[model samples]
Target: MVTSFLLLAGLGVLVVATAGVSWFMLNAMAPDVLPAFSTFLAVAVGVVTVEVFLGTGLVTLGAFLYNLSAQYSGGVEIAVTEALTGPPPANARALLLMARARRRLRTHIAPGDPGAGDRSSGARPARAQRETE
Candidate 1:
């Protein structure tokens, strides 16, 4: 989501820069027609603004709908495993430290997982765990 916004902002900046250069050249070539260049630049900016808003809206709507559906149907699951064939590298100590930190940050259950609320076996739900902490 952040990437999408950054990409659109970059595109807008590029379009505006290109239009400014074009306007400068047009003014130099035909000073009398500067108004036309200004109008063109205005229209281009308007179009880009509309495009950015529309794209952001669609992406937000899609995410919202997906989250709504995922609540009823369990979302996707992925399993990952790391394999090392050779001996660890010289930076193995740093890697191990980072790995340990990441493990501490990891969440066992995803928010949409059905098992997330199960506390029958003495495991507290996420909210309860946080409240106790």
Candidate 2:
């Protein structure tokens, strides 16, 4: 119901806007030619009517198709797990900051660079890289 109402409202606004622009353009080109306001109102109403019927039909069709598919393929599976509750460790903030800084700093290393550390492994000791630098 909510989806249908939203779809109808959105498309109705679009149709009305388009009709208004067309009416404005036609009136600007030739004033007092056709009943432009009435025509614009008619077109907007007609389009919105068609949109409501088609939109509702399509939504129903989609729902039917989804139900058919779900029967064959077990639908979506959601897993829920309880979070661990406790006060964080004393050095939690410092530890997290160090990890974040290490990640950001690691991006500067080049592949196969001497004393940079094994690419397959991870960062080498500072003592090893200090002499090379």
Candidate 3:
């Protein structure tokens, strides 16, 4: 209970801070770029901040519900393979597979995924040596 309250409060504080910064930036911009930039910043801040916060909330909620259910049910566990394949056709195994596959793709795009970009494991290409030929 207390933890959940704190989590929500923390999110509220973050949203306020982001909104404050966005407001300041809008006010600071000169008239020429103000309108365009302010609009852009407003949308960007709203999207990146709110959407991220919402996603965080959803993940937290999922974890919390899982824990609560586990506590009551004496625990529940599913193998990764089973989770991906689901039960059977009547249970919509194909839909579960597709959703899991999409989630795997989404995870690769998350913050620290190595394959996020085309960079070769953070290794830079060496400078080309002059050919003697």
Whose lDDT is greatest here? 2
Query: For each predicted model, how many residue pairs clash, with residues at least 3 apart or on different chains?
Result: 0, 0, 0
- Kindly report which residue stretches of model 1 are placed more than 4 angstroms away from their true locations once superposed: 1-3, 19-35, 77-133
lDDT of 2 at 26: 85
Which one is best on TM-score? 2
By TM-score, the candidates rank as 2, 1, 3
Sort the predicted structures by lDDT, highest score first.
Answer: 2, 1, 3
Candidate 1, 1-133: lDDT as tens digits: 5556678878888988898898889789889866776687888899889877787778767777877777789975332237746545757887888898877645654566444556576676566577789
Which pairs of residues collide in model 2? none
State the local distance difference test value for candidate 3.
0.61
Q: Which of the two, 2 or 3, has more TM-score? A: 2
Q: List the residue pairs that clash in candidate 1.
A: none
> Would you estimate the TM-scores of all the predictions?
0.41, 0.48, 0.29
Point out the worst 10-residue segment of candidate 2 by lDDT.
76-85
User: Looking at candidate 1, what is the lDDT of residue 15?
Assistant: 86
Q: Write the per-residue lDDT of candidate 2 for residues 13-115, one digit (tens) a residue.
A: 8888888888889889999985859776887888798888888888777777777887789995332337865537867887888999988767666555665
